[model samples]
Target chain A: MDRNIARLRNRLDGLGVSLRPHLKTAKSVEVARCVMNSPEGPAMVSTLKEAEQFAAAGVRDIIYAVGITPAKLARVAQLLEGGVDLAVILDTVEQARAVAEVSRQTGVRIPALIEIDCDGHRSGVRPTNQVQLVEIGQALAAGAELRGVLTHAGDSYRGGGAEALQHCAEVERLAVVDAARILQHAGLPCPVVSVGSTPTAHHATDLMGVTEVRAGVFVFFDLVMAGIGVCQVDDIALSVLATVIGHQREKGWIVTDGGWMALSRDRGTSKQTVDQGYGLVCDVNGTPYPDIIVADANQEHGILAARAGSNARLPDLAVGDRVRLLPNHACATAAQHGSYNVVRGSSHVVEAHWTRFGGW
Target chain B: MDRNIARLRNRLDGLGVSLRPHLKTAKSVEVARCVMNSPEGPAMVSTLKEAEQFAAAGVRDIIYAVGITPAKLARVAQLLEGGVDLAVILDTVEQARAVAEVSRQTGVRIPALIEIDCDGHRSGVRPTNQVQLVEIGQALAAGAELRGVLTHAGDSYRGGGAEALQHCAEVERLAVVDAARILQHAGLPCPVVSVGSTPTAHHATDLMGVTEVRAGVFVFFDLVMAGIGVCQVDDIALSVLATVIGHQREKGWIVTDGGWMALSRDRGTSKQTVDQGYGLVCDVNGTPYPDIIVADANQEHGILAARAGSNARLPDLAVGDRVRLLPNHACATAAQHGSYNVVRGSSHVVEAHWTRFGGW
Candidate 1:
């Protein structure tokens, strides 16, 4: 985790942009402290629960990155009144109006960013849709602070190799930069220009107009990121420990207690060149078993088998033998458990237990 | 939940078999009390955590339905010593030996059921494999109590309509009964016979030699169950409440705060005749919108869109408007949440909060 944090931190520092590590993946204050620029962070979060939790942990500069709803404004106000510089993101005039109204009503100037669509992957206004972008910025400037513009290169996960990732990073940069430029030309405060996704954050060759980069999953890379060439399989920092409970020897199946409930249902690698099934199987010492994967999963049973057409012999895993399964998507899989049984390096010895929280 | 519970209970009662409702779905004690045959429970659980929690809540007759491992026997022994009749299931002689060892060590005659594979879906010994079946039973009877046999029609989820489900039910019953006969022929005691799957439990025409039925998801029917003709969409008792936060009008997308984090990534209905995307979107009153579904999901954002090729108009839902999303798999979706906001049919008011526990 420290190596991953350092890799991104070094890259962004060289690009002259600050890092606002997204805390949604590792919802642990201990982990947050390691990745943040300081103990009191300028971090990003997907849910208000994260924002509130981090705020209590002394993270003052936090942005709730998911699109905001009017009903949630009260909670945002409470955070702001508590002296946290909590900001929100929105793409619609309706949402901007709601933020402004809440800011006025609470007598707390709520800071917000206009979410820009980088590649039409998910939410946000298109960079070329200047009218709506300016309207939203103007509405926020009326009462709330129009702090900046933000965009995520969510489509970057679809492609592999450095060239494709660099292109995605460029598109991400241009989208938020263009929106920030438009807001500036319209005499609106667009002080912060943010963009990222784990792939883009690692592969970007430039961040000239961006003020900060945001990413979460890099803290614990998984098979999806490895599939997209952002990291190697060995670079993945998270895995679910499972015990062999039974076997279907004729069918080459070694069943384990780790199932979809333990490893999430995120088949993020199904479309990749190599599908890792539910996850890649590994020895307890964190060494991958060649071509072995969780072929299928029930609620509490994972069927481990050799990958199709692979001659990889099924390891002689007996009942009570322990194995680790690397997750397809770290964020989704990590959300399944309450705490991380942290182990340093490849040691099997006990280490500190880091608690992770979940909820909207 | 009450109505769905009663539906399954009445069906099982007519078949003269007891209902040992699986508590893995609703991990809430309140919901378990509603679904169990009695407060003391003849219930089935997928994880040891559920067995321990329910046992702490006074559920004595519990079965850990997942195949047992030697490492987990200590906990089973602990439960047994605590006066809870915690039975276990296993298909291998190795597991049987471990159970026997634990029973001998702890001075608790651990009861175990030999798992019989009704269909080649997942775990369990094939009923036709008499040699293996008797071997496992003999191994259990040597030190542990050989209770009977159990089988689940896991493949029933693949087929829709009554005839297919009834066939699955009969196959499940025959598989367990055949295994019990094999044990009896070998002069081994076979007192209990268990068979089920939600569809099989509901559609079984005859329970002939079966002693008990086990089904979990039926307590809160989901879209998958409805698609398979085991229940209707209106009968689904669980949903994720979401707030409309934004829109991409040109794309016909209504964005909500509920994502895979809230709804879960279980696309169980995708293989069915009518694929409900992430979920079926309903109004606050619980009436589903015409052809509307959550088409895509990010970590914390659900994109609500009309079903492909449907001429249904997108409802003008504004920011802060609430909607309920019926899940594709009740067990998977409910596992994502910490508690259920109990409400009466079609009412928006939350009457109580029923906490659900998770972990292995």
Candidate 2:
């Protein structure tokens, strides 16, 4: 196995659990097949588009990881009926009620994983909100089945250091186990207590109550993850393959075809220790040459230059020369391109097209 | 005309020039038909997918406005041969020579538009690079028809005020006319000197050398333009109609289905005076309130709250209620969805569905 993959696997196994990696970041089925089928029973996804792709590629047991939109319930139910054990995550009783109503009407018998708010802010019900469990469980019992509870330590990225990872794990365990206990005491079956985030899943000392651990981005880590001390730059697998289109020799700038349009306009790691201006510029094989952080990006053109912390000097880059850029965030960067130009050791081997679905 | 349409049209007409709006932003055949059949000739497209769509919709004149990629040359050539007056833009002499070679070998004349870098340090040949110009013109003369010089006052967007508009016009006039004059005086009969951008074309002071205009965002003005003083907030035509899905009452957050995945992660106006966070949150009819700018966005969720600039007092916004979001950049935002739910007048009725195209 690749050292990065082996490192991630060993880390996950040390917690006495298996990693059911999330496929949201790597939207490619070819990539997901590599992750999910690797000693992991199931995986998680942010969109039904991912679900459809992964299912088409023969991954059966999966979880629609994000909060479900009511409009997509029918399609999700269809996926469930197609013998692919699909479970949805919802934080609110209303959403659970909607799912239950649809399930009862169609006799779909779909299972749901109630979402727990590890943090106070984003989506998901607070684990401290004990009454929500009884209420939501009763609502689900009327129409759907309550599988257990799921929580995402999303703010884990904010806690970038090893200490931050431990902090995130503490929050995750408390939230997931607390929510599970609430559901269990409510006379409902809470079998699976799932919690995820690359940092927490990688560093958590115990996975006592957690049945399934969901983590993505470990396969292809990013600058944001590296900045947070979660993974080193070497773990990142993907890069934007771009040609040096032009240059501003006077400004010591190298121009490339990879712009904000190619790398995405996400300043995901900007507030962190290392702000990868656009992204960390590298050779075609993903080796980082310090000087080239694509500094300023317009629509179709990226300006490559040396930022303040850069130690390297790009001595040989010229127009028409090719390079790759390791993105700050994988999901956001991957979403910018319509297809993944998947490379197996540098030859243009295969392309995994992503059909991004969007609607009300 | 509706207030939105009239406001946009009046601005373009006021400038004494018409806009060749990009179907890439609007993506509606009916709207393209209306704009083309109106006073403005066909249009420009940001992508070949859009160019193909418009060509099939009976549009005669079209510019595959972005820099031509080598992989797409065959398709562009095919479109030209299919009787579509597809004018493609090229910046480098290398690009011109390559395209010219393609045109020469195929025995089909593809109208080539030379791109002029008018202060936007992205793509395009520097207007002052004359030795390169003669070589490119000679190459075009050898095979491809040197139709004209094209300059996008792309920087005009950054210059949203009156002075900025004037700056746009000056640059447009100088870059296009000067480049065209250079080729013409060198004995290459370059007739057209095309120039445009919403900021410049909508505020054109003179057209001494410009033959035609290519301004796309004018047809569907965005929050960035609105923030820049080019267009009023009410002039923004298209918006993402999003249904509120969940809420974190304590945090005063209203979650919506229109996530970054739907809106795209292009924070086009984040560096502007009024950073419309994600986008400008508006009512169904396009009227923006001070309460919302879709404060934060994730892949499957858009957190609607008080505008970052305004007081954090959100309205009685609840779950399941729908709201509209005016985009940061019309092009990037429109690229996220498959089609538009085009509304006529102030009515919520779907007058027509605009089919969109994707891929490079």
Candidate 3:
């Protein structure tokens, strides 16, 4: 995790852009402290629950990255009034109007960013849709502080080589930068220009117009990121510790207590070139077993078997033997457990237990 | 939920078999109390966490339905010593030996059940493998109390008409009954004969020789169950309330705050005759929008769109408008939440808040 944090930190530092790590993946204050620029944070979160929890933990600068609803602005105002520089993201004029109304009503300057769509992956206004973008910006500037623009290269997870990732990074940069430029032209203050996704943050070659890069899953990279060439399999920092309960020797399956409840239902890698079924199976020491994966899972039982058509012999894992399953997606899998039993690379000695918070 | 409970209760009562409602779905004590045969339950659970939590709430009789490991026996022994009749299921002789060893050491007489594989869906010993079945039973009888046999027709989720479900139910029943007879032939006592799966429990035409039936997820019927003809769409008792935040009108997408984080990644209905994408989108009043579904989702965004190939027009849902999403799998979706805002049929007034417990 330290190495992953350092890798991105150094990369963004070289590009002359600050790294505002997204805390949605690791909802631990301890983890946030390690990745944040400071203890107070210039962090990003997906839910207000995260914003509130981090604010209570002394984090002041947070961007609630999801599109905001009018009903949620009261909580946002409360955080602002509590001395936290909490910002929200929105794409519509209706949302902008709501944010502005709440800001005026609460007598708190609510900061917000216009979400820009780069590749039409999910939410946000298209960069070329300058009319709606400016309208939304003008509405926010009326009462709320328009804090520039933001976009996520969500489509970057569709794997290509390094060239495609770099192209995606450039596309993401151009989207937010173009939106910020248009806002400036419309006599709106566009101060912050932000863009990211784990793949883009790692592969981005230039960030000339961007102020900060945001990413969450880099701290605990998973099979999805590895599949997209953003990281190696060994670079993944998260795994679910499981105990072998029994075996189906005739079917060549080893049953473990770690199932979807522990590993999550994210099949993020099924579309990748190599589909790590539910997860990749590893020894207790964090070494990957030969061609073994969680072939199927029930609510509480994971069936570990050799990958299809692989000749690798199933390991003689006895009942009560321990194994670690590397997840397909870090954020989804980590959300399953309450705490992380932190351990350093390859060594099983206990370090610390970091608590994780969840809910919206 | 009351209606769902009564339907199964009435069905099982007619079959003359006791109902051991699995608390794996609604991990709330209040919900458990509503569904259990009695306060001191003859209930089933998938995780020891549920067993421990329910036991703490005065649920005495619980069968940990997952195959047991030697390491978990200590916790089971603790529950048994606490005066809770905590039974565990296993298929292998190694697991049986481990349970027996733990029982002997703790002096708690841990009850054990031999799992029979009714269909080649997941774990359990095949009923025809009587030599191994008797071996496991005898191993349990050595120190642990060999209670009986259990089987789940997990493959019943693969949709067929009611006839197929009845056949699956019969297959599940005969497998456990045959295993119990094998154990009896070996001069071992087989007191309980258990069989279930939500579909099988509902469709079983005959339950002769079966002592008890267990089913979860029926408390909140999901799209998967409805697609399989087990229930109607209106019978679904669980739904995620979401607020519309934005829209991509050109793409006919209504964005909501509820994502996979709220709805879960269990696309259980995808393989059914009718696929309900992430979920079926409904109005605040619980009426589903014509052909509307959660087409795709990000971490905190659900994109609601018309079902593919449908001529249904997108509803003009403004920002802050509320909607409910009926899940694809009740168990998986409910696991994502910390609590349920209980409401009666078609009423928006939250009757009570039921806290849910999770972990293993």
Candidate 4:
């Protein structure tokens, strides 16, 4: 995790862009501190629950990346009044009006950002929707600050190779920058131009017009990231420690206690070249057990089987063998547990325990 | 939830079988209390944490349905010593011997059940493995009590219609009963014979040879159950309430705030006749929105799109329109949230908030 943080920080530093690491993956105060070690500290949060947690941990600046709804504005106002520089993102005029009304009613200054659609993946307005962007900007009434624009190339996860990632990152950067330019030309304050996705942030060649880059999963790279050519399987930092409870000898299956409940149901690597079923099984020391993969899972049991065509002699695993599992997606897997049992040394000794919060 | 509980209880009463409702669905004391309202107040738990929770809630007779691991035996012993009649399941002699060792060392009698494989879906020894079953039964040493057998026809989730479900229920019944008969023939005390799956329990014509039936996901029936011909869509008790935040008008998509994080990524209905993508979209009143389905989902955004051939005009969904989503799998979806904002009557008035626990 420390190495991953350093790699991203050093890369962003060289590119003259601030790293606003998304805490949605870790959701821990200690992790946020490590990621935001720079002089200008800020972070991106996906939910209001995350903003509350980071705010309590003394993170002054937080961008709630989800598009805001009126029902949740009072909670945002409460956070704003509590001395946190919390900003929200929106793409529609109705949302902008709601934010303005909430701020006006509460007498709290709410910082806002226009979410620009980069790769047509999830939420955000198209960069070319100048009229709608200007209208949304104009709708930011009293006690509201039109901060800038942000975009996430969420579709970057679909393709493979560094070239595809680079192209996606460029699209993300240009879209947000163009949106910021449009807002600025319309006499709106466009200071922070943010863009990211773990894949894009890792492979982008340049960030000329972007001021801040946000990425989450790189801190604990998973099978999906490795499948996309971002990092190798060895680079995955997070894994679930489980115990082999039984075996289906005839079927050549080793049953483990780590099911979908422990490993998560995120099959992010299903579309990749090597479709890792649930996860790749490994030894306690984090060494990959070749050919063994969690082929199927129940609520509390995982069936570990050898990959097809790899009919090499299977290990003689007993009833109480302990094994580790590498996840398909770091964000989903991390959210399954309340805390992480950190192991710092080569001996796989229990070091410090870090707690993470979830749910909204 | 109360209605669903009553319906199941009445059905099981007529069949003369004890219903040991699996509390894995709604891991709440309140829901458990409602489910255990009958004279036979015992409940089945998936995790030790649940056993602890139910024990604290005064549920004396509890069964930890998952296979036992030696590492968790001490905790089981602790619960046993606390006056809870906690029984655990295992299919291997190694596990049985470990349990026997722990029981002998701690001097706290641990009741054990042999998990019989009725279907080739997950854990358990096949019913035909009589020698192995007898060996496992005999492996129970000084402080261990062999308490019969249990089986879950987990593959009942596959294919639709009442005929398939009835066949699955019969298989589950006969397999567990046959395992018990073998154990009894070997001079082992085979008192209880348990078998079930939500679909099987609902469609089973007879439970004559079975002492108890264990079924989860029936309390909050989902699309999977509906697809399997066990329950209708209206029988689904749990639904995620979300707000329509944006739209891709040209693509006929209504973007919602309820994403895979909120609605879960369990695509259990993908193999069904009707492939409801992420979930079936409904209005706030719990009425199904005609031809609308969650076509795609991100971490925190659900794309509500019209079905392929359905050219019906979608109702104008404003930015703040609230909608409800019926999940693909109740167990997986319900695990995503900490609590359920329960509503009663057709008016959908939220009468109470019931908390549900998660994590192993």
lDDT, candidate 1, at B129? 96
Tens digits of per-residue lDDT for model 2, A182-229: 888888889989988888877898778888788888877888888888
- Tens-digit per-residue lDDT, B1-360, candidate 1: 889988988988899999998999999999999988789998999999999999999999998999999988999999999999999999899999999988888889999999888898889999999999999988998789999999999999997689988999999999999999999999999999999899999999999999999999999999999998889999999999999988888889989999999988898888899999999999988899989999999889999998998978888899889999999999989988889899998887899999999898
lDDT of 3 by residue, B1-360 (tens): 899999999999999999999999898999999999889998999998999999999999999998898878889999988899999999899988888888888888889998888998888999999899989888888899999999999999996999999999999999988888888998999999999989999999899999999999999999999999999999999999999988888898999999999998888888888889999999998899989999998888999999999989888899899999999999989999899998878988888999998888
Poorly placed runs, candidate 1 (over 4 Å): none
TM for every model, in the order presented, reads 0.99, 0.89, 0.99, 0.97
Per-residue error at A14 for model 4, in Å? 0.9
- Relative to the real complex, the DockQ score for model 4 comes to 0.68
DockQ-better candidate, 1 vs 4: 1
Clash list (residue pairs), candidate 1 = none
lDDT of each: 0.92, 0.77, 0.92, 0.87
Candidate 4: global Cα-lDDT? Answer: 0.87
**Model 1 CAPRI rating:** high
RMSD per model, one decimal: 0.9, 3.4, 0.9, 1.6
Task: Name the better of 1 and 2 by DockQ.
Answer: 1
Candidate 3: where are CA atoms >4 Å away? none
Candidate that beats the other on lDDT, 2 or 3, i.e. the better one: 3
